[model samples]
Target: MILSPYLILLIPVLYLIGWIYWFLKHKRPSLNMPRIISFHKISNTPELGGTFNTVKQFESFIRFLKMNGYKTARIDKILAEPEEKEILIFFDDAYENIYNEAFPIMKECGLTGVLCPVAGYIGKKNLWDRGLKRFRHMNENQLKEMSEAGFEIISHSMSHSDMRRLNKESLIKETTESKRTLENLLNKKIDYFIYPFGLYNENVKNAVKNAGYRAAFASYNEKNDKIDSFAIGRNTMYIIDSKFDLKIILERKPLFLFGHEDQKGRIINWFSRFSAVIKI
Candidate 1:
């Protein structure tokens, strides 16, 4: 069937309206400021509740951020120069596929990222997510290579367990042991801690600080206002997120375009808090 001239003419008008709506909803006047965001997996793994982004998609996404005048910087740099407009890319869960897929693309783009690996599961499969299909974590050598190549290697706890549920001794071990293991393996000072499952509380944050971490990150979908380093918020990225989704995050827009915590996320968080209260 052939379209009428009037209908064809209306197509562009409709496109313009949609574009304007997107701009009004997502544009950030303070876009030229520092921000922290995160990604996980960076692969198309078919697992329940798993977050990922294919290699090609990430490359284009990175390009889009740079094109929009966003500079990719490490966490330290962003902290040191808060006035500069930069984006800190944090990757949670050290998956081996990241070394094969995302790492190369990041190197090609002259960009670097922060990888938060579970110390106890290094070179092993993720056993925490029992129901979902498991995948291999990055090995010691891969972690070292990444560190040497200018990537920031950080900790995501000892075994990806909920920090809030951990007793004082267990929480201390998770924070201290993981930091020690990573520092020893990389022979570098590991200063940042990433809250596993994005679940944390005053006790968990205190444990991280008492463990000697300079800062910590959480999966809160907003920017950290230099309030408390231990509970710094981050925007999470997934395989489903497109370049537009990422742009909304990097821009620090008014809306939560991506990585909003869902029911499962809330359940894990609630369980963690409740278990901690009962001292379980």
Candidate 2:
């Protein structure tokens, strides 16, 4: 095939146009500080969960965080003053594989993470993900072992139900009961809560706060000029994500990171004003 001279000349022009678009789109006067991130199921298998990352990938990702000098979530991670390059890592759905697979890697990397588990389902299979694969939660003994190893254990919920779909009574039960159960089992204060499926509303956030949690995690760090600890949003890690994706997220310099979602995100933002009941 003969290359056309006109096409060759247009290549650099197109590249410049793409670069300019990205530069403007990702330009932020200030970045979101003290990063908060979430991950789940550090396994080699993909069928376990959508965010299931391979063990090798997990190790590499943690190493990158450590290289950048990101701090692990200590007891006062939320209340303390933000250190240089601050970050908090959260692991959801307390799969036993995390204890077996991720714990050692974290220890080797000299890092830690908060593990969120369904309080009522400790030592039992994840009934919520029963349709995927039969994965067990870390038993009480395992939970204690990880705690002794210096990993924080927090409440996911009683049964991992969507908080937005629950009534006020049910929402309270889910948040408060789970915290009570974990505290009783671990014999320590459970300070944080992560909403299941990344679903929440003002009511749900109020319930989490009333339940004695210092903070709660939801999915996607949308624009929150005033950061509310109760509904603190997080970016979900998927099996397909790369080192570049991790870099953009941790640095809070999203250039080409979310470029594919630009169109869809704009459409949603356009209708957001009209949808009084829907909260992003």
Candidate 3:
């Protein structure tokens, strides 16, 4: 059957619209000093967790950040100097793959990042590995080596559970115990907590604060203006996408701040997942 002329024309228009929408969605713009930027997970292998793996991609991202004049900082460093141009990176669960494959390159690039590990999962089979086929968490010795290398070791919950689905007691235990365990292992102050699965409610936030953490990180694409201290927003750097997406992210400040204003980040989360599936 022959297609109608209008339908053929409309197909190109739809494709163009989709392309432009994605182009704007992932673009990163250049900025001057005193800005906050961050990336997560620099492991050699990708997991079910949303992360950008691959040493070459990570190196390219580091070079992209450096070219844009962004400076990397440990989570504690960014918290200490909130006004400074800070790029706080978090490697959730502290996979040993990063130390084995990505650490040397990161150090050579002079990029520092936060390493948030599941306190109880260290030196054990991670839940992701049990069923998801992802790599295991880093061992205690690896965590120590990273700490000595200037990476801020922080909390990523005890079991990587969704805080929004947990009871009050469980939430408290996940936050408090993870912090305590990391502090004991590192022999240093652990003051930051990154919510696992980027899922949390007011109760979880309060639990984190009560657990003696100075700040908590969440997965929201918004510029933190000191008001969202406890629930600081973060932008995910996805794999299998062009670096141009970074340009879109940097340019669209208002989009980042209010992208989830209506649905409260659910839409953004969905879009990111869709992008990943389509290799956007």
Deviation of model 1 at 113, angstroms:
0.4
* lDDT at 131, model 3: 19
lDDT of the candidates, in the order given: 0.73, 0.72, 0.66
TM-score between candidate 3 and the true structure = 0.74
lDDT of 1: 0.73
Q: Relative to the unseen true structure, what is the C-alpha lDDT of residue 195 in candidate 2, on a scale of 0 to 100?
A: 79
Q: Considering lDDT, where higher is better, how would the candidates rank from best to worst? A: 1, 2, 3
Per-residue CA lDDT of candidate 1, range 81-193, in tens?
A: 76445778887888898888888877877788889999999999866553245678999999999999999998899977777888999999999999999999999998999
| Poorly placed runs, candidate 1 (over 4 Å) | 1-34, 130-132, 221-226, 254-280
Superposed by TM-score, candidate 3 places the C-alpha of residue 178 at a distance from the truth, in angstroms, of: 0.8
Q: Candidate 1 clashing pairs?
A: 52-239
Question: RMSD in Å for candidate 2, one decimal?
Answer: 6.7
Query: Over 4 Å off in model 2, which ranges?
Result: 1-32, 78-80, 130-132, 254-280
**lDDT tens readout by residue for model 2, 1-280:** 9889999999878866765664465433134444666677777765423557788888888888888877786746543565657777788888899998989988988888788888888999865542246678889999998988888888888977767888999998999899988888889999888877767888988899888888877664444344556666555566767777777776655544444333223333233223322332
Candidate 2 C-alpha error for residue 183, in Å: 0.7
